[model samples]
Target: MIELTLIGIGTGNPDHITMQAARAMNAANLILIPRKGEAKSDLVDLRRDICAQVLAATVRIVEFDMPVRDAGGDYAQGVQAWHDAIAAVWREEIARHLPAGGKLALLVWGDPSLYDSTLRIAERLPGVKVSVVAGITSIQALTAAHAIPLNPLAGSVVITTGRRLRAHGWPPGADTVVVMLDGGCAFEALDPAGVSIWWGAYLGMEHQALESGPLARMAPLIAGRRARLRARHGWIMDVYLMRKEPSNG
Candidate 1:
């Protein structure tokens, strides 16, 4: 049986890796790193850097090209098909490297339990014993970067994606909303009059940028800055939180 450990490396910061994740990385017989093309080659490079920093053992490290998702079909079908293709790649890599059951690890960007789907892909691997090592999330990094609490006064915070926010507007009963995987900056579609937003791009990195204030005042600034940052880096990862004051309700 292949012992598959999904280790959360936390926002590409080597310091964010938990001791448990470090131990798992050291113990793995083989580690798979996915290369996400030239535009995001830095992502794979960061994983390599993290391994060089934390790994003490001479474990086998292999890099594979990440498959691009087919955008022609319905969204859900396309995503499912994409996931299947990724799983096939994983299987092929394991067969080529291991050939026999052994310990393997994949360094995840953040806690697998969050919005990530690594666990779902792992489920497709037969006779594999799956384990997870948690690490800091981007939301935590975003909040800590801005020195703000996730929720105010014990208010409920709804964590959703940019698509959901743009399609449905603010969720009901949510006092604060954290948006992730938002390449489009969906906040522009909101009313933004009474909402306060704290936005962070490339959180926990040296080139990190942050902006906050009333959404009405900060929306354009955030949009402009986000565009410029993406243009400069060729890729960007960002998250934002919007809070509606009680007075505005």
Candidate 2:
């Protein structure tokens, strides 16, 4: 049986890795790092850097090209097909490297439990014993970087994806919302009058950028900045928190 360990390495910063994650990296017989092509080459480089910093000399590193989803098809169906393709790739790579079966690890960006699909993909590998090493999430980094609590005093916060926010609009009774995986500026769809936004890109990295202000005032600036950064870096990961004015309710 192959022992699969999903180690969360936090955002793009090497220092974000926990001791437990480091230990898992060092102990693994092989580590699989996915190449997301030139557009997101930095992602693969970050995984390599983590291995370089944490893995033992004897630990083997394997690289594989990741499958891209079919953007033309229905969103869910495209994602499902893409995930199956990835599972097939993983199986082939594992069989090629460790024909007899052995311990393997994958360094995940941010915590796997939060908006990550590594666990779901692992489930497709029947009889594979899965282990998880939790690390800081982008949400944690975003909140900490802003020095703000995730929710108002004793209030609840809804964590959601950008698509959901765009489709459903602001959720009912949720004073604060944290949005992730938003390729588009979904916030522009909402009435920005009473809402405030705290946005960050490349959190926990040297190239980190942050902006906070009334949604109406800062929405355009964030959009402009996001476009420029994405053009410059070839890719970008960002998250934002939006809160309605407490007194307005």
Worst 10 residues of 1 by lDDT: 240-249
Candidate 2 regions with alpha-carbon error over 4 angstroms? none
lDDT of 1 by residue, 104-179 (tens): 9999997999999899999898899999999899999999989999998979999999999999999999999999
lDDT for each candidate structure: 0.93, 0.93
Lowest lDDT sum, 10 consecutive residues, model 2, at: 48-57
Clashes of each: 0, 0
The positional error of residue 4 in candidate 1, measured at the CA in angstroms, is 0.4
lDDT tens per residue, model 2, 24-77: 888888999999989999898888887788766589898999998899969999
Q: TM-score for all predictions?
A: 0.98, 0.98
Compute the lDDT of residue 25 as modeled in candidate 1: 96
